[model samples]
Target: MSSTHHVTTESKPVRLLLIAVAAFILSLFLLLPLIAVFAEALRRGWELFLASLKEEEAWSAVKLTLMAAGLSVPLNTLFGLSAAWLVTKFRFRGRAFLLSLIDLPFAVSPVIAGMVWVLLFGAHGWFGPWLAEHDIRIIFALPGIVIATVFVTFPFVARELIPLMESQGADQEEAAVTLGAGGWRIFRSVTLPSIKWGLMYGVLLCNARAMGEFGAVSVVSGHIRGETNTLPLHIEVLYNEYQFSAAFACATILALLALVTLGIKSLVEHLSGHTSNSRH
Candidate 1:
């Protein structure tokens, strides 16, 4: 029989002290704030909680958030898959440079990310007058919101899949080709299954960020309630107006979304671990 044991370098008392300190800090910052939101949200009673969510402004914010996530996630998914494939499967000039470019969005601040769109698409912007002449809108509109979201969340899926697909290698794809499989067939049967969990993990994170994005969307959104405002913006608007309860109430949705994303990610990690173990 063979067995493996994890030996700690630190003494037991020291390890326990470190763990206790870390847990206390985590609870103080993360758990406490989450608890407060729910507590404050319900402080006004259940009627107010339901009413806050049911309000037209809150409803509109929810709708816009959903619309943004629904539109951006799929487009990003496609981009991510294509980028991952191109970078990992083929050798080309500037391949390293291209891979580096995928993370540019992450390095840029979200506020600056939004401003770039404004500069290009705003009325006084480079193409602004041309778009105006054509009666087309990009900035301060739904299109702007979607575009900002796409820019901000662009790195998530591609970053997730690139490393995974790279480590996987092209052996399976080449083997499939040798057996007369087409590109689509090989991708669907071999590539897709191999990367499905990574893809899902990326999408979950993208969706959450897409829904929760504030700074980039804020600059371009114009804060037009019932038209362009998202849930995060709505919360800010309410908080600014001193509607603490309603703000917290709206925040509950975002908090719940975070919790859901965390749960799914944990589950995915668990399953992935199981899969790797099973394979080995």
Candidate 2:
């Protein structure tokens, strides 16, 4: 018989000490910046903080940010669901290639992504003449912002879903089909419940990125105040104008969004774990 030795309590204390040191360092880097954002935001007292958000331009940025995220998230959710379903439920040629292509957004530079759209829509661009002739405008417009947001946040849901659903296998889906279940029926009754957590997680990340997308949206937005400016670009304008209080106030909203995302993520994780336990 092989013998196993227990780990010593002496080494346990050392491990705990090392963990404490790492935690301290991590908190300094991550937590400190978060704290700084809040501190700077509130430096001018509550009155200015409230006033900053009340500005018409600030309101416009908030609306645009929400609009972009609202549009982008749903489209990505559908795309992710479809991509995941196909990749996981069927064996097809070029499957790996398709999956790789899905991840291209992550590999590409945001600036380049925005520029690509520009080259397709700019005044002298490929489709520019035709679009202009047809009295259509896309470049330097809300549509351009929406498309750029969609491009940048595209992979979030699919990346989350593909692995989760793949591990689930096609067994249940095949069984559903064997029992004469339709495509929509199988997806609704079976696949939806299984992948809900991962889907939510993906949507969360997608929304976060959609709201905070700077580089790509910047190139397309044209920085029009109370018009094309999203929250991040608005923040940039505030900082440029030496409106530190206003800039920090906008930053604070995003910081709150980040916190909300974290809270929802934790709840989903807890619920997902509870579900697995119940099934077991």
Candidate 3:
């Protein structure tokens, strides 16, 4: 006879000790830092905190960060969907190579990615003369920031969807096509419905990374205040300038964004799980 062990029957003291250790680690590494950010932010009072956020430089950083995420997320989403569909739905030469290429960003350091762009677009770069002659500024500008964010966040959506799409196979899509459905119709009615959850999850992750990207953006941004500065970069500048309250205040915004992202992620996972259970 085969026997199974129940994990719940483990020693109570051991379980309690493990739980305590996990909780302590989480609080030390995550909760403590989050609490510290807000505490320092509000140390000088609400007025100072509000004033820090209201500063023109801070507002500019916020806008730039939003703009970068807005541009990068959509572009990456489109690329992700296309790449996933192509890889999962069709067989072709160099398919393995293509998959590796999709994962290139993850393998590359963000700082190196940013520097590559600079070497290609900066004043003394490969296209420098051409860009200079055309008065097209990319390096140390909004475009550069967006480009860096895009590179840093490139793999998120595609990575999220590839395994999902592969598991789903192309059966439903083929059936739709055999039923005389057009390309867009097949995608909308069959493919999209199947992959919607993964798609949304990927988009959320991509947005979070785009907004929070620092190493890549910093290398390309040149850190010009009110121009190339992003929220993370702004926080670094504040801290470097010894503006502790302002720095912490700016950090609180990022912390809040991280919390909101986590909340939405949990909600998405919960909803997806509930739906899955119902279907089963």
Clashes of each: 0, 0, 0
Ranking 1 against 2 by lDDT, winner: 1
What ranges in model 2 sit over 4 Å off?
1-10
- Tens digits of per-residue lDDT, candidate 1, 162-258, equal 9999999999999999999999999999999999999999999999899999999999999998889999999999999988889999999889988
Clashing pairs in 2: none
lDDT of 2 by residue, 1-280 (tens): 1333353445878979989999999999999999999999999999999999999999999999999999999999999999999998998999999999999999999999899989999889999999999988887889999999999999999999999998999999899999999999999999999899899989998888899999999998888899999999999999999999889999999888878888998898999999989999
lDDT of 3 at 141: 97
Q: Give each model's whole-structure lDDT.
A: 0.95, 0.92, 0.93
lDDT of 3: 0.93
* Higher-ranked by TM-score: 2 or 3: 3
| Higher-ranked by lDDT: 2 or 3 | 3
- TM-score of the candidate numbered 2? 0.95
Clashing pairs in 1: none
